[model samples]
Target: MAAGGSYGAALTDLGERLVGDVITPGDADYDEARKIFNTMIDRRPAAIAQCETAPDVAHAIRFARDHVLPLAVRGGGHSVAGMSLVDGGLVIDLRRMDAVTVDPGARTATVGGGAIMSGLDRATQPYGLATTGGRVSTTGVGGFVLGGGAGFLDRAFGLACDNLLSVDLVTAQGDQLHVDEKEHPELFWALHGGGGNFGVATAFTLRLHPLTTMTAMLLLWRPEAGPAVARAYRDFFESAPGQVGGGLLYLTGPPEEFVPDDMVDTLVCAVLLTYTGHEERARAITAPLLRLGHDAEMITELPYADLQCMLDDPPGYRNYWSAEYLDSFPDQAVDRFCARASDMVVPSPSQHVLFPQGAAVTEGPSDYPLPWRGAAWIVHPFGLWDDPADDARVRQWAHDTRADVRPWSRGAVYLNFIGREGRDRVIEGFGAENYHRLAGVKALYDPDNVFRLNHNIEPRIEPRPAGR
Candidate 1:
């Protein structure tokens, strides 16, 4: 069952048919190519097909099926669970296909499936247009959008999947399909938040909006200010305009010009408010937080693309992330959330975050299988560190963070926000009814469940008669 030449000439024939490089174990870049964002994942795929075209993807899919090799699709390779890789299988590495084409007149952008948020943001920046993208630039557009993407502009623009206009995908049977409202409509609905259970998307055309100006304001305080800051932030953000998006987080203070020497390398509380407008308007909306006598502050008006990279978490750190959606952030919930910050491994890239969700996010289409979108608040424990000794501790912190907020929990979760919890949680993410419908779609496009490396939705198979 190994993915090497044991499949005979089929492996060699696949290499000949592909328009991209067929990288194997002995290749010079195999080790580096196999690396993903999470340092803890050390998988070795038998063959890494760096696909550059739709044909390449189709060929790779057929190759894996013919050889009976486990198939994994790699876009940004940012899956916290390392879903983009397989230990001894074939990987459809789409990193080389990253490309972005913007149509300012039409207010839309056609993004290559492998394109990252940074590429999309930069491409649209010149046209004063953008869509909801990931919090950081490195996130894969395919996985982000398909999983109901959220970001600094989500409250203003809506989830990335909300902006999806069309998707060109290759199914498990090596069939190419252009899915939208008119064609393969059932599959289109599942694509809204279904992750990658259906197929390997080659490209996505997304609706873009005018975003000529953006402002970012960061107010920092000592770790002790977490509870008060969290409460005030909760109250301020609840009524703020949709244009305002950001969160309160506790992170190890970086050695930056805006960070105080005493705060650097120590856990510090920060309230970042991003406004999709000019600095003056952002300042007006964030004045309440500014008046809290922050020990350090930074306010700037910059392009959205520039702001997207400001909080980019460095890779090569062991990561374990999980989130809890809340109906309301009451004083008790705020206290519990703040209390968990003490458990975080300080001086690392970890962040204990509280994000507000409402406005465009809540008002977005309800038909999509994004049950967590209605939640008013999201408590995210994003743990990243270097030492394996802290593995148990970091993972426990994330789990305990979720447990702390269970009282006010909305009972639904964002699948992209957490690693694999269980099948029940996955069903909860898309609701029972929606999951049932998505399972049907999975049955149509991928009945054999070829693409099961995501927040997987198993194909729903019906029982047949006793005898044919």
Candidate 2:
């Protein structure tokens, strides 16, 4: 609905009823409210409802439904394809609802939907508890967990959705539900990897694990050694313990103390190894890679939360990314994966990463909609750069990276690692059977497809007999 139409009047009423502020296009914070993490996505929403509580979310949903306004849910504003924000629609901004409460006794965390990885990490750290979160601190816990989260701790703790105990969400019909194993079982099942199609997750209760001393190590090498390094990294994961996680990435070496002077501002390959124990154990586990590394190294034992921030990518970059889960990372495939790094824009936040996926990820529940977990390795190209002129350059590079690794592609993919490719890609993310099942759940809760933003799952509509 247009902002100047009946929405202007209806928006006023909705604003008064909401506990949070309702921001319109002319409002002081409208621009900031609509702004998301990806700079490439520039959209102007008609209204933005900054929801504070669960009731506020329901009210916003009802208002949007009543006025026939497109609805988008924002959590940490971190959707790479700008799924968090909608064009000329009403955004249910949940950034204000970020409050994480940790229960040390149960070793579970009840987090607000707006909570990011930092908030979650900080809350659970004092209790010596942690869960599978995103690679960086800025990623929203809701999007990450709902979309099948993968992080440095994933191999040890399993994907974020695997650790889900319960979820409190607001359906498209403006009804609040406490979904779990017992209550709303199907909806709970769909939440495993069913992005934001089912509903808006207002809160999440995640199972946590004990994590005391965590260590991180970065072994760097020149771009020429990428193929060999990739091979070694592939072999290392064959017997690597659950505590061993992280990726082999091609990135421009930053001007940090650990980066060599000559290698700075040039593309280089780095093997990032993260362990759930002390520095000694981390070194002992990754000793093989360290022996071959020559250029630079940054090894330190830090808190799990602190380690998450180490590779955090700053926002406000023109971002484009895609991933291809590999059935096998053969030496020839490794060469293709490394060769694509040359197409990436150097001195930017872009990373051509090959992450190992096995251990708990494959051994976990096979019933969930997540299909990419079974893959041996994941080739993800995360492209973040400035200047609109380089938009085509970075996009082509990310696309080419996926194409190069397609020979080893395991049919399925991780949706969270990529943006909206197409309907076929969405089906590829969730297997055919799981996709249909998730669509059935979508038909039940969001039949009208009110929540069709993130890697959308459309409701199955039965056709009528002949002409009406």
Candidate 3:
């Protein structure tokens, strides 16, 4: 709809009933409101409804429905493909609804949909409790958990969705539903890794685990040592304990106290091992990789919340990323995986990561839509760079990284680790059978596919008779 007459009038009327502000193109903060994490995404919505409550979300949904405007939901706006923003549409901005309530007694956290990893981690940290969160603290809890969250604690605690006890959602019809194992069981199952194809999740109650102390071990080596370090890292994690989690990656060595000056701002291979215990135990477990490392090392005991912020990617960088779950990472595959790192943009936040996925991840419930949980290893090409000129180069690097390791591909992927690949890849994110079931749930909640963003799951529509 055009931005005048009924469209403008509808927004004005909707704004009056909303508890939060309504931003339009002419609004002073419209640009700021639309700004997402990825600098590559530049979209202008007709109006943005900064929703503060579930009722506010319902109102925004109804307003968009009544006006026949495309609707988008924004949490942290961390979607790499910029799925949270739509051109000439209405965005239900949920950033204001970020409230975290932690219950140490029950070992649970009821997080607002807009809450980021930092808020969730910080809230649970004081209680000596934690849950599976995203790699970085800035990630939106809704999208991350809903898309099968993987992080440093995943190996020990399981995926974020695995810890989900309940989710408060606003359906396509602007109706609120409390989903959990008892109520809306099918929808709850889909929410495990189904993305936002079902509805707008207003809040989530996640199960938290005890984590008193955490340790991070960073051991770096020159880029040439990637292949050897990759092999040793892979072998080390194969038998590593569940309490151990992290990845071996090729990245620009940051100018930290432990890093050598010559290695700073240069491509370096590093093994970041995170242990869910004190530094003494972490050092003992990571002694294998410590032996092979040459350049620099930093091992310290820190709070889980503090560790979440360690790898937070700076915003406003163009991002392109893809992941391939592997059944096995043999020596040949390791060579290919390490070789592709040379193509990555140096002196950038980009990382060619090889992460091990096992322990609790494999032992978690198998009935959910998350098929990639069975993979032994995950190769993620996380591309973050500032220069628009290197866009094509960085993109090709990610694609080539995937192509190089295709032989070991496990056929399924984690949707949160990737962008908008395609319909087939989306199905692969959730296996074909799980996708079919999720589509049925989508049919029940969002038949018209109103929330057709993220890794979308299309609702199954039964056809009418020939002569309607």
Candidate 4:
């Protein structure tokens, strides 16, 4: 948190030029500006520049660099590690920049860096066009896409990054550049699964797909049925088409009509099958699960945007999330996954989910940083609860789930699903070879390593020629 002697004076000057407000520790709204999605993370940044334009972002970067304060970029403000918030540093808050412009003819959407998933989804939904976005509506589009977005539609449309067309970036040195496959090819490639290591992305152009109607079938059963349901779900996904996507989760059932009174507010296993097609066809394809005889059921066809918001976790809960991608989910693994449900805090928003991966996810671009896409299954422990007392138990449950499934692990990490585990996991997220390549790109754009918050990729310095 140290800075040079003139840092305080320089910050005063930097705040004067911005169209958006610059919030410091003394400001009445400072605490509000610093709040992120994860309630557990509380950071006191030296300043928060709520950027209204890319130029504003560039200037903030310049000022932070000159003052020698660490920099953190805030998009969606949903980082579980709270990477978007830095302690006693500068934060480039992009929430004000959210604006979505869609080109139905071109099948693409250009989104502001600060926009959330709902903004992009609502804009494109009117056109009967869609894209792969995060499962939750409130998740920031910038962070989700940059971290390799995956959601209910991912199996059908591919990960959100797979649909990315271009990005507008503001480098650590305050240079603005447009990167696409044609321009800054290597830099464009790094954006695939690379965390925000190179720069602050001011905007993104993403490809869109046609999705007229989306269907979801939620079937639930008692906790004792989890092992059976898990095994059946795994078998079903083995041959299901790419349009079939969703997860088998152990959660406390909500007070829905379909949910039995006994199951409501109690832990139960649920299988959700999301199909990109219409209701009748989707139901026909997933009839096997329908016949499994669940304690409750809810099947409906809804707008893609509406489906995205259905699972929005209520905000006040403390969160601790993690994931482990698996090479295969055998019957034994199913039992282990089900057993971990006992450790989860019952009647909470916690979910012990097993996601199937394949089809479009595995068949997508192989060279991208998403090496974990090839895994057959993903075990995600998304924990949320209201009490600080349950913090230790939630953390332990996530840790134990990863440990229990270590044998089946493919040794890959999904950067978005897990919190900041360590440097080694970051390297594993992108394969070692891809990590090296990303480091080189990081060196070129961020040689000084100004953006080191998110699953950071260290810059590799290239030596000058002997003649020099």
Model 4, stretches more than 4 Å misplaced? 1-9, 464-468
Q: State the lDDT of candidate 3 residue by residue for 251-364, as single tens digits.
A: 999999889899999999998999999988888888888888478988889999999999999998999999999999999999999888899899999999999999999999
- Predictions in order: lDDT: 0.92, 0.90, 0.91, 0.91
Off by over 4 Å in 3: 1-6, 463-468
lDDT of 1 by residue, 24-77 (tens): 876678888899999998998889888999999999998888777899999998
* Deviation of model 3 at 329, angstroms: 0.5
Which pairs in model 4 have colliding backbones?
Answer: none
- Model 1 TM-score is 0.98
Per-residue lDDT over 161-231 for candidate 2, one digit per residue giving the tens place of the 0 to 100 score: 99999999999998999999999999999999998898888899999999987998888999998888888
**Per-residue C-alpha lDDT of model 4 across residues 91-191, encoded as one tens digit per residue:** 99999999999999999999999999999999999899999999889999998998899899888888999999999999988999999999999999999
Clashes of each: 0, 0, 0, 0
User: Which ten-residue region of model 2 has the weakest summed lDDT?
Assistant: 1-10
Each model's TM-score, in the order given?
0.98, 0.97, 0.98, 0.97
CA lDDT, candidate 4, residue 351? 94
In TM-score terms, candidate 4 sits at: 0.97
Instruction: Quote the RMSD, in angstroms, for model 4.
Output: 2.2
